[model samples]
Target chain A: GIQVEQSPPDLILQEGANSTLRCNFSDSVNNLQWFHQNPWGQLINLFYIPSGTKQNGRLSATTVATERYSLLYISSSQTTDSGVYFCAVENIDQAGTALIFGKGTTLSVSS
Target chain B: DTAVSQTPKYLVTQMGNDKSIKCEQNLGHDTMYWYKQDSKKFLKIMFSYNNKELIINETVPNRFSPKSPDKAHLNLHINSLELGDSAVYFCASSQVNPANTGELFFGEGSRLTVL
Candidate 1:
């Protein structure tokens, strides 16, 4: 089984600030995704980046498949951004297309 | 319209009780999954179905059974639930693409509380 570890287990930032979250996987992955679990317990898909970089408004993500790591960036964060950010990956060795998720980085953006 | 939807957003039951959570996805995806998130907010895949066929079954107990009557629906039934079973259950769906494994879209979680 592949292991997914997210850094900065917890983060707090003032509104309008910028932050970065990191995820490291123990093995090569065929699929990688970023998700945001809002305070309402809704898991929203942020990005699906397996090996490249992509930006979605104030949120962007980059995955270095060779390095087995990914970075998620949030710029000019707003108070509504408070929640947990998760990084999930599907290992190449995995039998099915199930994703193994990281513990997640809890983010708090205060206005 | 919701891409993925689960019934009974919240459930409260006593230990040993049996309950069922229903999931449906209108995204026309071929794969559906059930995930559990514990109090620590750690998410883990429990089961996955591709085109109404069981594809991935983790080390989940037999008490937890998942049924996919069709590709668009997957239901989870828990029998003799224990206190430890209390957690948020999420239903997700994705389309398998040749270019890469599909990205998962999760529904608003169903929070279960076992007394």
Candidate 2:
């Protein structure tokens, strides 16, 4: 089994601020995705970046597969973005079958 | 359209009861999975099925059984549940391909409580 670690287990920010969350894996991965779980407990896919970078609205993510790390950036964060952010990866050996998730970074955005 | 949907979004039962959660994916993905999110918000894979066949089975207890009748459906059945079994269960589906990042689309999650 591969290990996935997320930094800054908890975060709090005022609305309109910016922040970055990080995820590190213990091995190489063929599939990597970032997800945001809203207050209503709905999991929304943010990015599917096994490598390279991707951006969507105020959310963006970059995965440096060779370094075994990925970063998620939130620009001008909003109250609706206050929730848990998760990074999950599938080991190359698994053949992109299953995903191993990090503990998640809990984000709280206040107005 | 709801890409991935699970029935009984919330479930509460006694310690010795048996319950089942049903999941269906209309995305037509070849692989479906069951994941458990604990109180600490740690999501772990419980089971993985590819086109109605079991593929990945974690070190979960035998009391937990997952059945996939077809490619579009995967159901989880828990027997003799205990208090420790209380957690949020998520049903997800993805297109499994080694050449691409298999992004999983998850359901709204089923919150299970054992009293």
Candidate 3:
């Protein structure tokens, strides 16, 4: 029951542009996360990276996890970075559970 | 100072109503999470409490019930409420085993509206 897929479901950048957001998982993952739901909804957790890279400022994340996929990088963006961007997974057959989300990636950073 | 604090930020019940949603974590976390954001946002993960026990229970039905009296509280009880139980409910915290390793610290969402 692990299937998280998120890509440019919708995105529109302007203010000091720079972006890349993707997450695709169908299997193997102990845990992985990246969230930012702003615009008043408030989710904000930007990256737990169950595998590799991490930055956090202008934000950055990369979790290759042997190709299961994950990448979220937003360089000079602003306007509070707009909204919605989630990618969560906790597979590996779900032991030590809960976390399976990805149906988001709706940023609109315009300045 | 609000590591994770959830409450009745909004909840409007009706249809055979029975509601309860309250979670708190001052970061002394031992693990506590319950997420459900529908209405297209779709971030789902029902219950998960680590110190007060009850470790994850997805599929979430049984009229939904999750209660953890210690380890910083985890409470969500929803009985007859319907209309798909509306949406938006998030409360999170981390740190427990194999290093739950930072990051999850959300809780500014409650917005339920069953009608």
Candidate 4:
């Protein structure tokens, strides 16, 4: 089984602050995805960047597979962005079947 | 048009009881997965089904079983539930092709409390 670890288990940000969330994997992975568990408990897919950078509005993610790590950027955070951000990876051991999720970075955005 | 839908958004049961959570996907995906999110918000894979066949079953206890009657439905059954079984259950579906990038669409998690 592959191990996925996320950094900064807890985070707090002001309405206009910027932050970066990181995820480090112990082994090579075939896929990586960033997810945001909103206040309503809905798991929203943020990005599917397995090895590159992608920007979606105030959110962006970069995955450096060679280094076995990934980063998620939240620029000028909003109250609505307050939730848990999870980085899930599919490693070679599973043949890209299941996702091994990290503990997640709990982000709290204040007004 | 929810891509993934799960029934019984919340379940409260006593220990030693049995319960089931049903999941259905309309995204035309061949793969469905069951994940459990613990109190500390760490999600772990419990089961994986592809085309109605079980593919991956993590070290999940034998008390938990997953049944996929068709390509669009995967239901989970838990026997002799325990207090430790309390967690949020999430059902997700994704296209099976490797090129699909393993992007999963999850359901509004079902919060289960085993008292």
DockQ per candidate, 2 decimals: 0.85, 0.91, 0.32, 0.89
Residue lDDT tens for model 2, A1-111: 899999889999999999999999999998899999998989999999999999999889999999999999999999999999999998988775698999999999999
Per-residue alpha-carbon lDDT of candidate 4 for residues A45-111, written as tens digits (9 for 90 to 100): 9999889899999999999999999999999899999999999998966674798899999999999
Q: For residues A26-56, could you state the per-residue lDDT of candidate 3 as single tens digits?
A: 8899789898888899988777888989897
Which residue pairs come into collision in candidate 2? none
Clashing pairs in 3: none
Candidate 3 CAPRI grade = acceptable
Residue B52 accuracy (lDDT) in model 4: 95
Q: Tens digits of per-residue lDDT for model 3 on B38-105?
A: 88888887888888998878788899898999989999999999998899889888885766564577
lDDT of 2 by residue, B33-109 (tens): 99999988889999999879999899999999999999999999999999999999999999884434487999999
lDDT of 1 by residue, B5-114 (tens): 99989999999999999999998888999999999999999999988988889899999999999999999999999999999999999987443457899989899999
Q: Candidate 4 at A81: error in angstroms? A: 0.7
Model 1 agreement with the true structure over A17-64: per-residue lDDT tens digits? 999999999999988999999998889999999899999999999999
Error of 4 at B107 (Å): 0.5
Query: How much DockQ does model 2 earn?
Result: 0.91
* Docking quality tier of model 2: high
**lDDT (CA) per prediction:** 0.93, 0.93, 0.86, 0.93
Candidate 2 regions exceeding 4 Å error are B97-101
Local error of candidate 3 at B100, Å? 24
By lDDT, the better pick of 2 and 4 is: 2
